[model samples]
Each structure stands twice: as C-alpha cells, then as structure tokens.
Target: MRILVIGGSFGGLTVAFSLRQKLGARHEIVLVSKEARFTFIPSLPWVAMGWRRMADISFDLAPVLSRWKVGFVEAAVIRIDPAKKQVHTAVETLDYDYLVIATGHRSANEAVPGLGPFDGPGHSLMSPPEAEEAREAWTAFLDSPGPMVIGCAPGASCIGPAYEFAFEVHHALARRGLRHKVPIVFVTPEPHLGHFGVGGFGKARQFLEGEFEARDIRYRTSAAIASISAEAVQLVDGPSLPSRYSMILPALSGVRAVAESGLGNPKGFIPVDAHYRHKDHPAIYAVGVAVALPPVEETPVPVNFPKTSNMTRQMAAVAAHNLAADILGGAPVTRTLSAECILDMGDRGAHMFADPIRPPRNRSEMSIGRRWLWAKRAYERYCLWRLKRGWAGPASGLLG
Candidate 1:
C-alpha cells in the first residue's frame, strides 16, 4: 500500500509517524511539506516576545522522517486531484492508494485588510517568520510606548494564541516598565470572553474576565474589526481606537491547493466522516484545521470552531488506525474530540480540560496557578523530545 500525507505539521506528522508504526515494513509512506523544518507552533508567542529563538522551536523534517523510514518531499502542493488519486507538487506528481490531508490552515489575512506582518501595520504569531517579524516590531514599539491592540479577526478558530500573546505582551511590557504607558486592548468576535469558539468552558469566561480586569487589559467582546491603519483600528459598530502597535490574529482558511481540488467545502476545509475519512473520497482523510467542523453553537458575531493541537493529534491517530485497519484485518478505532490546553499568562497560566469539546460533558476541569506556567514549559520540552523519538501514541495528557 502507498500512503501519502500532504503536510508535515502536528496533524500531518502524527499521521505519518503513527501510520508508519502501525504498518511497519508493509507499506510505502511519503510525507510532503512546504517547509523543510517543523516548528512547534504553540511556542511562537514566546518567539515573538524574544523569550525563544526560532532554532529552539524548529527542527529539520528530513532527518526526523527519514529515521521513521518515510519519504520526505519539501515542496508546496499546488493541486490535489482526489478523482485521480494524484497530488501535484511544485516539483513532481505522486499517486497514492490512501491520502491524508493535513494541510492545516492558511492565514486569511485578506479577510481583514491591513492585518499582517508584511504590507500591514499589525503583526502576527502564526509562523516562525511572522513571529520573528513580530519580535522586531515589538523591539521598535519599546522605543516609543503607546496604545496597543491584540485580538482575533472574524471566523478565526485559533483563539488561545491571541489570549497568550496578549498576556505575554503585557508581561513583557510590564517588565520593561512600559505597560502602563501602553494601554493594551483585546478585541474578539467571540460573544464573550473565553468562548474559544467552542462555547464557554467551565468558569473560563469568569476566569479570563478576572485576569483581564486584574491586569487592566481592556477587552471588547463581539467586536467586528472593519479594518486597520498605521495609527488606528476601525470597528464596525464602535469608534476607532488609536493603536501604536497591533497584533491581530487573522481567520484561518483552507489551503489553496485543497480548496482548488474540488474536494473541500466553500471555505476550503475538507469534510470528513466520524472516522476522519473524507466524506466523498473514502481513500482520502483529513485532520486538524484542514478538516471542516461546525461550531458548537452560533453567536451574534461569527466564530469558527477551534481545532487545537491535542484534538488534531487524536484525529490523526484515529485516521491512522482506520487506514491500518483497511489493509490489515481489524476493527477501526473511533476517538472523541477533546481539548487540554495551558493558557500561559507569562508568570501564571490556566489549565483547562474538556471532554467531547462541547459543554455538558462528563469532565470539565479548569485551574489557574503559577505551576501551570512551569507545566507548560515542561510540556514544550517533552513534546519536542517525544517527536524526536517518533512516539505517536494516544495524546491524552499532551498540552497545547
């Protein structure tokens, strides 16, 4: 059997390594990624804040995948033909018996004009390059302190990072004794604080509100950002705010290749069944933000459902297991979507665990303390070590 994975990020790497482990010496596996290095995305905020260097969070993919006996292709996937079972990259075209679409998301900066690192006034922490750019921008901001805006654009699912960046910026500025001079504002489309695109978790709204209040980080919920300029951000319903520095998390959209393949939805996300198999293409599967997921519930302002790293890992495991079952004789496994996250507030953090993602769950736990900050740092080290060892077991306790 020939299996092709179309990405090399958290979801793609997990699928490739786990599937290779499940069908060792029995099938050919190829992992394709646009970048040569794999970055620990959750730590990008630290990179932006100058707490971490790019090298600390990224490693070469060639060495890691080669150790697992998987072929690595470092090229952008220009197109995907599900009908023909072929993937066309910038360099070559490859055909596969089974295809896993873990292409993740493309930052939809175009959705919000003037909202990006380059060609815009605001910065982002989505990628290593962007984070590095943000670091430079932040350094410049420190030379002259003023009002700052930190928030997520409409349709954005990656909400946790926005919160993390806001707090980290606060901590960094406070350390420099410039936090009071630069008033920080958090603006989100979520109906309330801590909704996180999955409705409100256990006491999350109250907890976040309290934290923001304590820090004097003003926030605007259900805010619709019309656009951003070099000096200010314009809101649809409210008055424009003068901002000397802005960090806006743009919405995530489907990759252009997948969207053009005619296999994805209008938003460019691939629709998958309960087992993570593509709805129409049985041999194709999708995990991570590349897979289409409906929101837990609708709100006044639009909010896309989140696909965290831990949840994506679970989806990848299930997809890999099912693909293995297709070749070998066994029942496929089904895993529920859950989230375990540590929202780092620099010196302190909050750990939240939700089973089944939505509310009314069997287990919904949340705690806040300085230990969680230490735990988050420890998890980062453990994750890098585990990935280096090619361990792809159940991601039950993994923090993201």
Candidate 2:
C-alpha cells in the first residue's frame, strides 16, 4: 500500500509520522509540498517584530522526512486526478493508493484591496517574505511613528495572529518609549474580543477586554475593512482610521490546485467525514486548514472556524488511524478535536483551552500571566526539537 500526503507543515508531518509508527514498513508513505522548510507559523508575529528570525522557527523538510524514512518530493502540486488516483506535480506525476490533502491555505488578498504587503500599501505576516517585509516596515515606522492599525478582514478565520501582533506592538512601542507618541487601534470581524471563531472560551472575553483597557489599545469589533490606502484603513460602514502602518489578516481560501482539480469545495477546502475521509472518495482524506469547517455561529461579520495547530494534529491522528485500518483490516477510529494555545503578549501571555473545540465543552480554561510567556517559549523549542527528530507523538500534552 502507498499513501501520498500533500503539504509538509503541521498536518502533513503529523500524518506521516503517525502512519510510519502504526504501519511500520508494511506500507510506503510519501509527502509532497512546495515549502522546503517546516515553519512554525504561530510565531510569525514575532518574526515581523524582529524578535525572532525565519531560521529560528523553521527547519528544512527534506532532512526531517528522510530521518523518518518517508519519501520527500519538493514540488508544487499542479493538480489531482482522483479517477486515476494520481497527483500531478511540476516535477512529475505520482500515484497513490490513498491520498491526504493537507495543503493549508491561500491568503485571499483579493478579498480586500491593498491588503497585501508587496502588492499594496498594507502589510501582512502570513509568510516568511511577508513577515520580513513587515519587519522592514516596522523598522521604518520606529523612526517616524504615527497611528498604527492591526486587525483582520471579514471572513478571516485565523485571527489569533492579529491579536498577538497588536499586543506585541504595544509592548514594543512602550519599550522604545514611543507608546504615548503612536496611537494603536485593533479592528476585527469577530463580533467580540476572544470569540476566536469557536465561540467564547471561559473568561477570555473579559480577560482580553481588561488587557486592552490596561494597555490603552482602542478596538472596533464587527468592523469590516473596505480597503487599505497609504494613509488610512477605510471601513465599509464607519469612519476611516488614519494609519501610518497597518497589518491585516485577510480571508483564507483553499489553494488553486485543489479547486482546479475539483477535489474540494469552491473555496478549495475539502469536505470530509468524521474520520477525515472525503465524502465522495474514501481513499482521499484531508485535515488542517485544507478541510472545510463551518462557522460555530452567525455574527455581524462573517468569521469561519479556526483550524488551529492542535486541532490539525487531532485530525491527523484520526486520519492516519482510519487510513491504516483500511489497509490492515480493522474498524475505523474517530475522535473529537480539542484546542489549547498560549498567546504571547510581549511580556505576558494567555493560556486558553477548549475540549472538543466548541461550546458546552467538558473542560475549558483561560489564564493570563507571565509564566505562560515562558511556557510558550519553552514549548516552541520543544516542538522544534521533537519534530526535527521525527517525533510526532501526543507527548507534548495540551501545548501540542
């Protein structure tokens, strides 16, 4: 048996490792991805702020996969021929008995004019280049500081980075003794702070509100950005916000390859059943941001469900189990996803957890303090060390 996994980030690596451990040498596992390195995307805001470099959070994917005995193909996937059970890449076409689509997301910069860093006046931290560009802009801003805008566009599901950037900016400016000179404002499509696209968890709303107030960061909730210009961020229904620098998280859509191949929805996200198996093709499975997930509830502005790293790991485990079962002869396994993340706040941070990912969960907690900051840093190092050596087991606890 052979399995082909598209993507080399959290989802792909986890699936590969999980399968290698479960199936041993009985089946072949190969991974295809455009990125040569596995970057810790959650730390991108720090990269933009110059606190961490790209190398600090990223490692070459080839070496890691080779160490795990998984075949590695560095190529951009052009399309998938489901009927033939083949995946076409620019380098070559590969066949597979089973396929796992974990091709992350494509930032929909077209959703809002001037929302991209290189293409427009706005800045972003989505990719390595974008984060470096934002860092350059930040360096320039320090010389002549003014009003700063940090927020997310409508339909943005991955919003934690925006919040993290805002808080980090506050700390950065204060450290430079420019906090009073430059006014900062946070805007988001979420109806309220701490909604996190999975509904409110514990006292997150209150905790974030308190933090914002103490830090003197003004915010606009349920706000939609119409466009971004050199000097301001115009809202769809409200007044424009004057800004010298801005970082906005745009809406995310599935990659063009998946959409063109007809393997996913119109937006490119694959539809999957409980076991992360494709509804139409049992041999095809998907996890991570590549999977289509509905919003938890309706809000004034659209906000899709967040596919956090922790949730993606859970999906990978379940998908690996089911795929192995099909080949080895066993019943399928299914499990609910749980999320836990520590948000870095410059000097302090917040630790939040949600069992089952949505409301009415059995266990949920939110805590704020400086210890979480240390814990986050420690966990990041731990993750890099573990994944570098091809250990993807669930030993990292809730931090994973």
Candidate 3:
C-alpha cells in the first residue's frame, strides 16, 4: 500500500516513524513536508531562553526517514483531492492509498491588529524564527531593565506558553540580579489561569491567581488584546497595558492550503470522526491541530483550542492504527485520549487535572507539587533520550 503523510512536525514525523516501524518494508511510506528538519517544539522555550541551542532541538529529517526506508519529499502541499486520493504539492501530484493530514496549526497572527512578523512592538514565539527573534528581545531586556508584557490575543488557544514565558522570564530576571528592575506582566483571554485552554483545571485557576500575587507578576484575566503597539497593548473594553517589549500567543487556525481547499470547518480546521477519518472523505485521515476538537466549555470569550502536540500524537497514533486496520481487514481501534499535560510555573511546577481520555461529563481530576515538577522534568529528559534512540517516550500521566 502506498501511504502518504503530509506535514513534518510532531504529528507527521511521529506518525511516519511509528508506521514505518510497525509495518516494516512490506508497505511503502512517504512523507511530505515543507521543511527539511523536524523541530521538537516543546524545547522552543528553552531555545528562546538560551538553555539549549537550535541545533540541539532540530533533527535532519531526510537522513532519519532514509534510515527508516520511507520516501521523503520536501514540498508544500497546495491542495488535496479526496475523490482522487491524491495530494497536489507545489512540485507535483502524489497519489496515496492512505492519506494522513497532520499539517499542524497555523499561527493566525493577523487575527489581531498588527501582531506579528516582529514588524514593530509585536513579537511571538510560535516558530523557530520567531523564537529566535523573541530571544533577541529577551537578551535586550536582560541588558537593560524594562517592562515586559506577555499575553494571548482574544480567542487565542495554547495559553500555557504565555504563562510559562512569563514565569520563566521572572525567574531568569531574579537569577540575573535584575528582578527588582524588571516588571513582568501577563495577559490572557482565559477567565483565569489553569483554564489553560480547557477552562481552569481543578483549583488551577486559584493557584495561578495566587502564584502571580506571590511572584509580583501583574496579570489580567478575561482580557482581550485588541491591538499591540511598540510600547503599549490595547485591550478591548479593558485598560491598556503598557510594555517596553511584548510577546503574545496568537490564535491558531488551519493551514493555508487546507483552508483554501475548503476542506476545513469554519475555524479553518478539518473535522474528523471517532476513527479520525475525515468527515468529508474516508480515505483522508487528519491528526493534530489540523483537526478541530470542540472546546470543553463556552467561555465569556473564546480562549481555548483542543489541538495540542500531545493530543496530536494521540490523534496520529489512532489514525495510523485505523488505517492499518482497514488495509488488513480488522476492527479500527478507538480510544479516548486523556488530557494529561504538565504546566511549569517557574520555581516549582504544578501537575494539574486528570480526565479519562475524552473526559467524562465536565469532570477533571488534579494534583500539584514540587515532586510533580521533578517528574515533568524527568519526562522531558526521558523523551529527548528516547527520541535520540529513535523511540517515542511512554505516555504521560494525566496528573503527573
């Protein structure tokens, strides 16, 4: 069978690697990506903070895929025709017996007025290039004390990074003996912290609220960032927040080509069924942020998205199993992926929330501690080591 995978980020690379290992040389596998390297996105913050260099996190894709004997192509997918079971790239049309779309999320920086490309006061850490730019800005801040503002625009998803950056900055400043000189502020559209794009996990909201108070980090919850200028961030119906430099997590939408092909939902994200088969086409399966997973709850304003890297991997694994099932004539595996994520809050991280995969009835369980933070760190190291050895790490606990 000819299996073609699109996008080379977490979902794409992970799925390809796993499928190759599972199926061996019996079936042909192909991977299409715009870039020649795979980035471990979770390490981007460390890269931005100078804890690790870019090369430390980036791995050459061609060689790795070659070692696995999977066909690799560096081309941007321009369109997909489910009827034809083919993906049209900028170079040529590639046919697929099974298609997996894992193009990842697109940062909709333009969603807010003048918010990206580092054109002015606006900056982001969503990509490798942008992370470098933000790093430069951070270095400048370190050399000279200034007011720092980090936040998310209205309706933005992936709120965890904003909190992480804010806390990390504060910790870095304190370590540099400039904590008193630098003023840190955090802004987000979520009603409160721990909401974490899933509506405040357990007592997470209260914990985050108190954490900032103790850290002397000013924050505004339920705030919608409207426009960002060189020295100021304008919030809709809220007081303008001042800053010398700013980094905000923009809302993520579907990829340009997927959106252009009219294959995605209103949010520009594709929709998939329980088996991860595209609702519009059975041959096409989508994993990762490319597929839209409904938000857990309705908020005062939209501030969450269901698509995350871990969730994306789960989605891709499910897609791979189901696709294999179809080819081998077996039952498709369907399992709910539990929401197990660790959020770092500076000195000590907190482990919050445990839900059965797909959460049962507005229910989420959680626990917090310094031990959990250590465990999270252990997990990161374990994952890096495993990846280096060509292995995907074990599953993370929902509340570890």
Tens-digit lDDT track for model 1 on 27-103?
99999999998889999999999999999988889998999999999999999888788999988999999999999
Candidate 3 residue-wise lDDT, 39-82, digit = tens: 87776776678776788777778877887788999999999887
Give every collision pair in model 1.
none
**By how many angstroms RMSD does model 3 differ from the true structure?**
2.8
Task: Decide which is better by TM-score, 2 or 3.
Answer: 2
lDDT tens readout by residue for model 2, 293-352: 989999999998999888898898889888888988799878878889999988998999
- Backbone clash tally (model 2): 0
Instruction: Name the lDDT value of residue 98 in candidate 3.
Output: 90
Sliding window of 10 residues with minimal summed lDDT for model 3 = 391-400
The local distance difference test score of each candidate is 0.89, 0.91, 0.78
Could you estimate the TM-score for every candidate?
0.97, 0.97, 0.93
Per-prediction backbone clash count: 0, 0, 5
- In model 2, the worst 10-residue window by lDDT is 391-400
Give the Cα-based TM-score of candidate 3 against the true structure. Answer: 0.93
